[model samples]
Every structure is written in C-alpha cells, then in structure tokens.
Target: MKILLLTLGLGLVCGLQGLDNSAKGSPKLDGKWFTVALASNVTSKIEEGGSLRIFVYNIRVYDGFLTADFFKRENGKCIPFSVTAITKEDGSNLVHYDGLNDFSLESFDDEYSIFMLYNIKDGEVTIWGELFGRTPDLPDEIKKKFEEICERFGIGKDQIRDLYNDDRCEKLR
Candidate 1:
C-alpha cells in the first residue's frame, strides 16, 4: 500500500513539473541582450588593407567590441540579457534593440565607446559605436580574445550572420 502511494505522488510531481515547463506568456525577444559572434563575420569596405587596420595600436579604430544592453520594454518586460561587451575606449558599442529580437550588454566601469546605426523597426532602436575603457573586473586575456573576434566580425562591410543564433544560449525578454 505504501509503495503504491509513493508511486502516485511521484507521478503527480512529474505532471506538475511538465505543466510548469509549458506555462509561458507572449515571450518577446524584444529589447537588448548580450550576444557573441557564432564564428561567422564580415569586413568593412574601407578596411580592406587600409590605414585603419591595427585596432590595438594605430589607426582611428572605427570599430570595437559590441557590448549590448537594454532598457525595459514599454510593456514592463524586464530587460533581457545585459552583459558588458568589453571594448576599447576609442569607440562606443552600438546595437539595435528590437521588439522581436535584440542584445543587451555593457563592458565595464568608466567605459565608453562610439557607434552609429539606425532603427528600422517599430518600438526598436539601433546603437553602434566605438567602445572605450573596459571594466576592471575583466581580464586582459579575455579582452584580447574579444578583440580578436571583433576584428573578424565587427567590420561594417562584413555581413556575415551568426553561426548560431542560440550561440550564448542567452535568455531573451
């Protein structure tokens, strides 16, 4: 009798878990979130062996790491994922916040960058810029790695799509 009762309780627990998993509302990928290039990248037309090539040293460094972030939706949905994109102080991180999809990121303290982009969607905004100083919490190795990736991916002429949309397995708002 006790064994049967235990089995019944276990079944109920499993059912409840399943219900919880399926319970969801209008999940919006809206607003900003943190993301990384899925290994695919494009290059800017002007940067094809030009004077502005070396990002760490010379050249006006037009592009840097993109650290996306966000503000809450007008509907009061909490900002999705916000991770600092760690970039050089020479520019700002620009990103386009979308109602259906976006990225959230911030690099570090006393950090700044440059960006230029436009928004083509309703209830959405695009931001892109040259980034500056990164957070002290970040390590040089990680920052260097990010720089390498940025050099490969952040070129304006490069129109490569993400290798994996769920690359970071990020949580969307």
Candidate 2:
C-alpha cells in the first residue's frame, strides 16, 4: 500500500511539472511575424508632429494594433522610443494611432512599412503591428532588407502564414 501511494504521488508531481512547463512557454499566435515598413519615412513629410506611421498585421489571425512613437539611437546606446499617445482596442482589432518612437530605416523608399509580431497568452492570441513610413517609396533592395529582419526574428511572413489558419487577411490599407 505504501509503495503504491508513493508512486501515485510521484506521478502526479511529474504530470504537474509537465503542465507548468507548457504553460510558461505558451506559444503566441502571433509568434512568427514580418515587418512591412519603417516609421520615420512616414513622419518626415508631415509638418505636424502628430504624423501617423507604423502598422503591423497578423496575416495569420487577421488582427492587431499599432501605437506610433519616435525612436532615436545615440552613440553606443539602445534605441529609445518616445510613445506619444495611449491608443487602446480590443483583441484582433486594427486601428490607426500615433505615439511611438520613430524607427527610421532610410534605406527603404516606401511611405509606409510594418513590423509584425503577435502576443500569445493563455492560449488566446493577439497581433501587434509596428508601422514605419517615409516620404518616398521603399526601394526593392530596402524592402528586401526589411524582409531579412523579419526572417532573422523568426517572423518570416511566408513560413508562419503557411502554418497559420488560411482565413487570415491583411488589415492595413
């Protein structure tokens, strides 16, 4: 009887350990994503400091949001973002908002671009869209560079989209 009870206790402990691990490493639905543009490019042409930029899409689940900001990097320092507003929305929702540090990738020639990433929590999913833009359109070469960044981040649009549900749509206009 004692041995049986010990075995049951150990089994329960092991089962719970497995459950805990899976819970913490919960994969985000937006785990893999892509960046379509940069923010500075969109803001430069606008005289208004309130220039809007940056849009992320969850080509997988078809939902996400972007809050704009101006990002600046100093010598030997991490890029700093200045969030300008508090835009809020429901999950999988897409809305245009301003208030973030500008990510200026001058190499791209587009008036707009995107950073796509998703947040997965408790098996629930939400997409995040980081939008960037410029006065000029993004050159093909620069566009490729942006794609490279997405690939490096494990957010390649092709690979993830292939695995995600096919019903998703591109929300950015």
Candidate 3:
C-alpha cells in the first residue's frame, strides 16, 4: 500500500510539471502567419479551389493547445475557420477537423515554418506539407527549402502551389 501511494504521488507531481510547462506555450509559433505554399501527395487538395488552400491570419498557443484562425475561399466567398490542436505530451499535435489530423512541426524559425500534416478520413490517408511565413512574400531560398521538404515527403515540385498572390481571402486577412 505504501509503495502504491508513493508511485501515485510521483505520477501526480510529474503530471503537474508537464501541465505547467505546457502552459508557458509555444512562443516561437504564436504569431501572425501567412500561407506561402502548400504541397500534398494528393494533388487535388492543394489545387485551385481546393479545400486545403487556406490563408492563415494568426496562431495562438496556450494551455497545451494551439489554435489557428484562417480564411477559406469557397464559392467566391471568404469563410472564416478555426482549428485547435491539442499538444500531446510527446510534443505532437492532434486535430479533429473534417478528419483526424496529426500535425508535426518539421522545421520552424521566427520568420518561417514548415509543417507536415497526416490526415485520415474515411479510411483514406493524405499527407500535406504546409509552408508559412511571417509575411505573405517569402524569399526564393525559403521556397527552395519548402520544396526540399516536400520532396522528402514524396511530394514533387509539380504538386506544390504558390499562394502568395492569391488574394481571394484578402478581405478576411
């Protein structure tokens, strides 16, 4: 009984520590962001008028979760959308939107970030490579980096789309 009590106490302490750490939030990832480019194994998902072609306004991280606010152009109208992902203990993010999305931060800095999203819906799996920048326009080198990352994920350059000039959702931005 004493051993069990000690183990329980330790577990509670560890859990609290984790919660406190998570509360500090992902500072580097919390800020205004724009969708610079998108690549997907499923080509249609990143094509024009595709559901994955979204313009991000900002991202907020808090309480072990990250929330993104963005706009999606549908039927010639801009529609606002928000997605929240819980940060797992292992530093992964899980989102439930239109499907179960497992997002992993491939690389990030203050100015740019690349995220890989694995989505499973209706027994179909799709991989998405998303590139975001602090500004709408990204340098050629940054775009090259995104291309390299996409190549690593089996997404060819042809599958990538540059959304820098896409202003359909600019009003919402």
Candidate 4:
C-alpha cells in the first residue's frame, strides 16, 4: 500500500511538472488580440500625440498553417487585410506570412506577446512590430518589455508611440 501511494504521488508530481513547463511558454496567438503598442513605418507618421491608432489582429492556426486578419483605423476609416502563414520550422514559434512578412516571436507571457515583423525586399529590411495582449490594458512589465525591444531595435522614444489607450478595434470580419 505504501509503495502504491508513493508511485501515484510521483506520477502526479511529474504530470504537474509538465503542466508548469507548458504554462510558462509563449501565449497562443489565436483569437482576437488587441494592439498595446506598435512601432513601424505606419506609426512613425503619427504627428499628433493624442491621436490614437486602433488595431487588432486575429490569427487562426490549422493544419500546419496560420491565417491572420488585420484591422486598423486610419483617416476615419477602418482598413483590413488578410494573409495566410505557415510556421517557419518545427518547434519554432515564428510564422511566415504570404512569403514576404516574417512574424517572429519576441517574447510572451500569459497577458501579452510581442511579434517583430520583417518585410524583406531587394536586400532591404523594413522592421515592424506590435505588442499584443489578450486584453486591451496590460501590466507594466509587458510595457517595459516592449520598450526594451524598441530600444534594442533603435526605435527612438519619439518613434515609439503609446497606443495602449486607444480604443479596441471593431471586428473586421
């Protein structure tokens, strides 16, 4: 009886260890993700400080492929675009969109995730990135992580606009 109880306890411990490992990894990108902040060619055009930019990304992963839908508000109009993507490699979190856009995983936790996108063309790299969250409002740690990434990418403080207070985007589809 003692040996049986010990064995069961060990199994439970092992199972919980596995669970913890999975839980700490990057948050899944599927479902509606609100943009916390964005640093890109688009955001750099915002001349007004208080003007908020609203964006949302919806991602669906299926059968070794991913489909992403992007919606953004600009000039009092909502623009939408869709692209199909596939994982770059096995066990990699990065996804390649439409063969030109590379959405590479930067960091993620339960509340938020960051993806750095590179638009490669003719030997030039245009860098774009977004800080996405499960909710509209995120904790400070997530914000700091985004700041760190922007700094690392040589995006000046003026270039990193805060879109965290922007309204959530309406569904595009």
* lDDT score for residue 85 of model 3: 75
Candidate 2 lDDT over 29-49, as tens digits, reads: 222233334322223312122
Estimated TM-score per prediction?
A: 0.20, 0.26, 0.80, 0.64
Candidate number that wins on TM-score, 1 or 3: 3
* lDDT of candidate 4 over 1-173, digit per residue (tens): 44532332232211111112223454555677777777764463333332223365676655555666776566756777666754432222333432254445567656776766654444444556678888777888778888887677666555666666554455444
User: Is candidate 2 or 3 superior in TM-score?
Assistant: 3
Candidate 1 per-residue lDDT, tens place, 1-173, comes to 44532332232211111112122552222222232221112133112231111121111211333333432322333333333333223222223233211222222222222122222245332222223223212344544444543443343323322212222222332
For 1-173, candidate 3 gives per-residue lDDT tens digits of 44532332232212112333233443377778999998999988778787677778888767666789988878888889899976555444677866776666767777898877766677676778889999888999999999998897778999998887778376666
RMSD of each: 20.4, 19.2, 8.7, 13.4
What's the lDDT for residue 98 in model 3?
Answer: 62
TM-score of 4: 0.64
Local distance difference test, each candidate? 0.27, 0.30, 0.74, 0.56
Candidate 4 runs further than 4 Å off = 1-26, 41-54, 88-99, 121-124, 171-173
Ranking by lDDT: 3, 4, 2, 1
TM-score of 2: 0.26
Candidate 3, poorest ten consecutive residues by summed lDDT:
8-17
Considering every candidate listed, which one attains the maximal TM-score? 3
- Worst 10 contiguous positions by lDDT, candidate 2: 12-21
